[model samples]
Target chain A: MATTSEIQSNRDLFERVARRRRRQHAEQTVFTWLLRAAVLISILTTVGIVIILVSQSVGFFAEVSPWEFLTGTEWAPLFSPQKFGVLSLVGGTLLVAVIAGLVSLTLGLGSAIFLSEYAPERLRRVLKPILEVLAGIPTVVYGYFALTFVTPILQNIFGHDQVIVFNALSAGLVMGLMIMPMVSTLSEDAMVAVPRSLRDAAYALGATRFEVSTKVVIPAALSGIVASFILGVSRAIGETMIVKIAAGATPNLTLNPLESIQAMTAYIVQVSLGETPQGSLEYKTIFAVGLLLFVMTLAMNIVGRWVISRFRQQYE
Target chain B: MNKQESIINKRQKLHAIRVLRDRIFVVGFALAVVVGILGLAALLFDVLIDGLPFLNINFLSSYASRKAENSGILAPLAGTIWIVGMTALLTIPIGVGTAIYLEEFASKNRFNRLIELNIANLAGVPSVIYGLLGLAVFVQFLFNGSRSVTAGALTMTLLILPIVVIASQEAMKAVPSSYRDAAYAMGANRWQVVKAVVLPQALPGMMSGIILALSRAIGESAPILIISSLVWVTFIPTSPDSKFTVLPLQIFTWVSQPQHSFRGIAAAAIIVLLIVLLSMNGIAIWIRSKYQSRPDQ
Candidate 1:
C-alpha cells in the first residue's frame, strides 16, 4: 500500500495538464471562428442581396416613382415614350394565381382529407409516392406541357378565335396542376398532426368520416391548411417559364383568362431577354420588381411558417 | 313497439347515407389521382413523341441552328455541365459546413432560432429573385458587366444554398445521440468524432441532396436568364469568364423563335434535360430509401 501511494504521487500525476488545456483552447478558438464565419455569411448574404437590389432599383425609383410602379395600368416599360405600369403585371399574376389557388384548394384539401381520414394502408403507400413524383417533375417540363398540350385543350374549350395561341388560362390551369401536390402534401401533414384522441372522440360521438374530416380534422389543421394556401400562392407568384411560355407577354390589364397578360416574373424574363442597356433605369427596374417579388414571397413564407409551426406544436 | 321500430328505421337510413357519402368521397379521391397521373403521363408522352424521334448521337453532338436546319444543343449542354459542376462545388462546402455548425455546435437559443427561420425563408424565395441578385451583385458589381459562366454558377450557388443547408441539417439530425455519447465515452474529441464518424455516415444524404440541388440548378431558367445572356456561343466555355448558354435558356430561345422546326429542337433539348432531371431525382430517391430507418424503430 505504501509503495502504491508513492508511485501514484511520483508519476508526475498532472503532467501535460497545461498542454491539454492549451490544445482545447486552440480547438475552441477555431470552432468559434468557424461558427462566426457561418453566421456572418448567412447574414451577409441576406444584407448583400437586399443592398444590391435596392442600389440598382434606385434608378428605377428615380425614373418611375413607387406609386406609379405599384399602380400603373399599362405595362409598357419599353417601346416609344414607355408606359410604366406595375398593375398590368400584378393583374395578370393575380388572375392566374387566384384561379390556380381555387383549383388547388378544392382538389388538394379534398385529397388530403381522403388520404388522411379515409385511405386504407395500401392506397396511402401508392398515393404518397405518386404525389412525391408529381412534385419532382421540373417546372420547365411543366412549361412545355402547358405550351403544347394544355394550350390546345384550352383552345378547344374557348374555340379558335377566343383563345390566344398562348394565354393565361392554360398557364393557370397547368400551374394548378403543378402546385396541387404541394397543397395536398402540406395539408396532409396538417391533417396527420391532428391528435388521434380527437378522432377517437369524434367516433365515440357518432361522427362519420366526412363529418370528422370536415369539422374536426380540418378545424384542428386549419393553420396548416392556411399555410398550404399561402405556400401555394408563393409558388404561383414566383413561377416564371411556364407563364412566360404559356401566358404570352402582352401586359394588357385584363381579368379574362382567355387573353394573354405578362406577370411580374415574366417581365423580368422579357426585360432580360433583350438588349436593355445594363445600369439603365429600364434595366434596373427588373431588380426593383424582383425586390417587390422577394418581399411578397418572404411575407407569405413567414405567415406560412408560423401557421405550420403552430399546427405542429399541437400534435406529436 | 311502434316508436322503437321507427327509431331503428331512421338509424338505418342515416347509416346508409353515411356509407353512400364515404363511397362518393372514395370515388372523388380516385378520380383526382387518375387525373394527376394522366396529366404527368401526357407530358412525358409529349416529350417522348417530339424529342425521342430525334434523340440520337447527332442531336447531342451538334451545335444550335440559326436557320433551324442544323441546330444542336452541344454548347448549351456543355454550359449546363460546367455551371452545374461549379455550383455543386460552391454549394457543397458552404452548405455542408453550415449544417454541421447548426446541428453540432449551435446552442439552442433565440439567435439560432432566427437563423433557422431565416434559412427557411431563404429556401422559399423565388428562383428568379436569385437571378436579379446575380445580375446586380455578381454580373455587374463583382464581374463588372460580365455575363460569364462564373456569374451563372455563382448565382445558382446562392439559389440552391438554402435547400442544401436544410437537407444537410435534416440528415445530420438523423444521426443518433447514442453515437455521439459512445464516441465521448471512448474519449474522442468532438471534432474527431464528427469528422471520423458523423460526416462519413451523413455523406450519402448530403451527396444525394447535392445531386438533386444541382438538378434543379441545371433546369433553372429564371436566374440563369439574368446571369447568362442568350448569345449564340457555339464554342464550349473554356474558362469561368467565357460566355455560355444553358439548356433551359437555349430551350427558351428556340421555343420562342419564329421558325417551327426550332420547336422540334427545343423539344429534343427538353427531353435531354428531363433525363438529367429524372436521373438526379432517381438517385435522391434511392439514397432516401437506403438511409431511411423507420422513425419509430
Candidate 2:
C-alpha cells in the first residue's frame, strides 16, 4: 500500500534515529570509562601510601631490628647511643590521648545532651554553629594557645615547678577542646535519631528529663557515642602541632601529664625539622613511626565504621 | 495507715531529690557550653591582643630575618598562595569527577562499596602521614630529594583529596533524582542527563564544599613542615620547583623562638592566617545558604 518514495523517506528517518541512539550509547560508554578511571585514582592513592610507608619502613627495619624498635623504652635516635625504643613515644601519645579522651567525652557528651534534649530548636540552631567554630581553628593556632596561654594558666594552678613550660597537660587539654565539636556533633546526631517513643515511654513511667536523657536516649545511642569516642582518640593520636609545640620533644618514659613528653607525631616533626639525611636510620625512623601511627588510627577507624554501620542497621 | 504514710513521704522525698538533681544537671550542661565558647573567645582575644602591635604592612611584605623586627611573611604567604592554587587545580577535577563516577555511574556492587570504604578510611588518615608519603614518594623519589613547592603542593593535594571527594559526593547525592529522570525522559543518555541536569544543581554545593576543604588546607602546617623544613625562606617561590614555606609553617618557626618580639610577629602571622581562613569559610557558608534558600527549578 506504501508508495516507493514514502517508504524511502520512512527508512531514512529510522536510520537517523538509530544513528543518534548509537552515538549516544557510544558517548555514554566512553564517559563511564573515564569516570571509572577517576575512581581508580583514589584506590591508587591508598596503594601508593602503603607502598611508600612499607618500602621505606622495611629499609628502616633492616637497619634497626623490629623487636628493638617496637619494644625499646628509649627513643633518642639522634642523640648519642642512638636508642630507638618507640614505647616512650607511644606512652606519651597514649597519656595525651587519655587526657584528651576524658576532657572531650565529659564536656562533649554534656553539651551534646543539652543540645539534643534541653535546648529548644532555635537555641540549638544558634549554638551548634558557634561550637563548631572550635573545630574550624587550625591545630597550629591551638598549639600556640596551649604553649603561651594554657601552660601559664596550668603553672599558676599547679605551681611553676609542677607544670613545666612544655608539659603534656596543656597540649592534651587543648587537643580535647579541638576535637570536642566532632564528638558533640556526631553524638548529637545519634541522640537525635533515638525514637521519640522511647522518651515518651520513659516519661510515662514518671522519669525526669535528666533521667530519660541519660538512661533512655544515651543507651539508645550508645554505639554512635562509642564510635565518636574512638574517632576522637584516633584524632588525638594523630595530632602533631599541638603536641610538637606545647608538649616538649623530650622522649621521657613518664605517665605524669605535667612532665614534658614527646608524642610519636612530635618525634616525627622533631626529626624532620632538623637535617636528617635520606636513607639514614634517623630519617627512616619517621616512616617506621608513621607505620605504627597508621596502623593504630586505621584499626580505630575500622572499628568505628563497623560500630556505626551496626548501629545504623539496628535503627534502619 | 502508718505504713502508707511513710511510703508516701519517701516517694515525695525521692521526687524532690530528682527535681533538684535535674536542675543541677541542667546547670552543668549549660556550664559545658560556656567552657567551649569561652575557650574560643579567649583564643581570639589573645591572638588579637598579642599580634595587633606587630601587624603592620612591613610584616606582611618583608621576608623572614634573624631579627624579629625585620622578619616578614612575604615569602611564606606567597608560598601558601602558590601551594593552595596548585592544590585546587589538582583536586577539583579529580575529586568532582570521582564523585560523579561513584554517585552516577558506578553500579552499587561489592567493588564500588570497597572504593567507598577506602575513601572513608583515607579521610581518617592523618595529615602528617601524607607528609611521610610525600617525603618518600614525591620529594625523594620524584624530585631527587628536593623539598620543592611542587612536592609540598602535591602532598597537600593528597592530604585534602579525601575531604574534597567526600564533600563533592555529598553534593552530588543531594541533587534530586527527579532532574535526572526529566533529562532521561527527554531522550538524554546517562552522560547527557548528568552533564545537563545534575551538575548545574550540584555545582553550588560542590563549589562551597571545595572552598571549605581548601580553607582547611590553608591552615594545615604539619605536612608542609615535614615536606619543606627550610624555615628561613627570604624570597617568594616563582615556580613549582622553588623552595617554599607557608603561613602556618612561618608562624611555627616564629613561635618556636624564645624571644618575646618573635611571639608578637607570630601573632601577626596568625591574624593573616585567620583572616584568610575566616573569609573562605564565610564565603562557603554564604554560598551554601544562598543556594539552599532558592526555589527549586
Candidate 3:
C-alpha cells in the first residue's frame, strides 16, 4: 500500500537496525573471548610450573638415580661425595614441621576456642585484627626474630650450651607463630559454623562452658579443625626464610629439634642464592627438591580442601 | 536421711569442681591471646629499638656499602618500587579481567569449576615454589638466564594473581544481583550492566583487595631472593630489565651478615618496609569501612 519511495526508506531503516544489532553481537563475542583468554592464563600458569618442574627434574634424575635421591641419608649434592639423599632434608623439614605443629595446635586452637566461644563481639573484633597483624608480618622479619630474639631466649632458658644459635626449635617456634593466624582463623570459622542449638542444648543439660566447648562444639568441628591443622603443617613445611635464617643450613639426619638442621625450603634458597649456572646439576637438584616440596604441599592442600568441603557439605 | 545428705554434698562438690575447671579453662584461653599479642609486641619493640637509631634520610638515600655505617636502602628501595609497580600493572588487568569473566561471563559448568579449583590450589602453593617457577620460566627460559627486574615482576605477578582474582571475585559477588537486573531492565547489555552498575559498587572492594595484595608483594622476600641474587646492587634500577634487588632481599642480606652493625641497618630497613605495608593495610581497611558505611545512607 506504501509508495515506492516510502517503501525504499523503510527497507533502509530496517537494514541499519540489523547492522547495529550484528555489530553488538560481534562486540559481545569478542569481549567474551577476551575474558575466556584471561581465565586461560591462570590454567596456563599452573601448566607452566608443572612443565618447568618436570622437565628440569628429569635432567636431575637422569644423573642422580631417583632411588638414591629418595633413599639417601646424605643431601650434600655440592660436596665431594655428592650424596643426593633427600631423606635428610625431609627429616629436617618434618622435625621443624612437627614442632611447629604442636605449637600452632595448642596456641592456635586455644585462641580459636576463646574467640568463637568466650570473647564478646567487641573484644573479638579488636583481638582478631591484632592476631591477623601477626600473619601479615613478613616471614623474613620472623626469620630475623627467630635468629636473634627467640634463639637467645631459648639459649637463656636451656643454657647457652644446650640450645645452639641456629637450632630448629627457634625456627619452628617462629614458623608456628607465623602460621597461627591461619589455624585460628580457619578453626574459628568452623567453630562459628557450628549450630547455636548445639551449644544451647549443652547448656540446658548443665554442661559447663569448658565441657560444652570440648565435648560438643569441638567434636562437631573436628573435620574443619583437622583441615586447619593439615594446612598449617603444609605451610610450615613450605616456609623458607625462617628456616634459612634461623635453622642452620647443615643437612643433618637427626630428629632432635635442638640441633641445627636444614629444611628442604632452606636448601632451595641456599642453592638459588648461590651463583649456580642454569642447567647445572646443582640447579637441577633444586628443581628435584622443589618437585618433592610441591607434591607434598599439593597433596596436603588437596586433602585439606576435601575435608573442608566435606565439612561444609554437612551443614549445607 | 544420711544417704540423701551425702548425695547432696557430693553434687555440690561436683558442681564446684566443674566451676573451678571452667575458670581455669577461661584463664588458659585468655592467656593464649595474651601470648600472641605479647609476641607481636616483642617483635615490634625489638625491631624498633634496633633499627630506629639508623633510620635517617641518609639511610634512605644511600646505596649498599662495604661499610655498614655508610649503607642506605636507595638501590633496593628503588628496585622494590619498580618491581611492585610493574607487578601491579601486569596483575591488575589480568586479575580483574579473570575475576570479571568468572563472575559475569562464564557459564556455570564443570570447566569453570575446575578453573576455580585450580586457582584455589594455586593460592595454597608455596611462595618459594613460585620462586622456582619464576627462576625456571622467567629468569632462565624467557630472559635467557637473566635475573632482570622484568622477570622478577612477572614472577611476582604470577604469585599474587590468584589472590587478586579471589578478592575481586568476592567483591563482584558482593554486588547485589538487583543492580544487574535493573540495568538489564533498562535495555543495557550484560557488558553495560557490569561496566556501569556492578563495577561502581565493586570498585572500592576491588581497590582494597589490590592494595592488600600489593602490600603482600612488597613484603615478600623468598621469591625475590631466588630471582635477584645480585646482592650488592649499588645503583638504582633504571629500567625493567635492570638487575635489581628488593627491600626484603636487602633486609635478608643484612640479616645474614655476622657484623653487629648490619643488624641495626637491617632493622631500619624493616621499619621502612613495615611502614609501607602498614600504611597500605590501613588505607585498605579505611576504604572498606567507608564503602561499607555508605550503603547505610
TM-score of each: 0.93, 0.97, 0.97
lDDT of 1 by residue, A1-316 (tens): 5697788766655556657767976886687577567656666678777887788788788878888888889877787678788888888888888877877777788778777888898988888777667677767777878888888888898798999987888888888888888999999988888899999999899887777887798988898899999999888999998888889988878989999888899989889888899877788878888888888888888888877776564555
Using lDDT, give the best candidate's number.
3
Docking class of 1: medium
Sort the predicted structures by DockQ, highest score first: 3, 2, 1
The alpha-carbon root-mean-square deviation between model 3 and the true structure, to one decimal in Å, is 1.7
Native A-B interface contacts kept, per candidate:
0.45, 0.70, 0.68
Better of 1 and 3 by lDDT: 3
- Candidate 2 pairs with clashing backbones: none
lDDT of each residue in B153-269, candidate 3, tens digit only: 999999999999999999999888987999889877777777888888999999999999998899999999998888899999898779999999999999999898899999999
lDDT of 1 at A300: 84
lDDT per model, in order? 0.83, 0.91, 0.92
Interface RMSD of 2: 1.0
Model 1, B81-196: lDDT tens per residue? Answer: 99998988888888887888888878889998788877887788888888888887888889999999999998998888888988888787877888888988987777766777
The 10 consecutive residues of candidate 3 chain B with the worst lDDT sum are B288-297
**Candidate 3's DockQ:** 0.78
Assess chain B of each prediction and give its TM-score.
0.94, 0.97, 0.98
lDDT tens per residue, model 2, A283-310:
8899999999999999999998789888
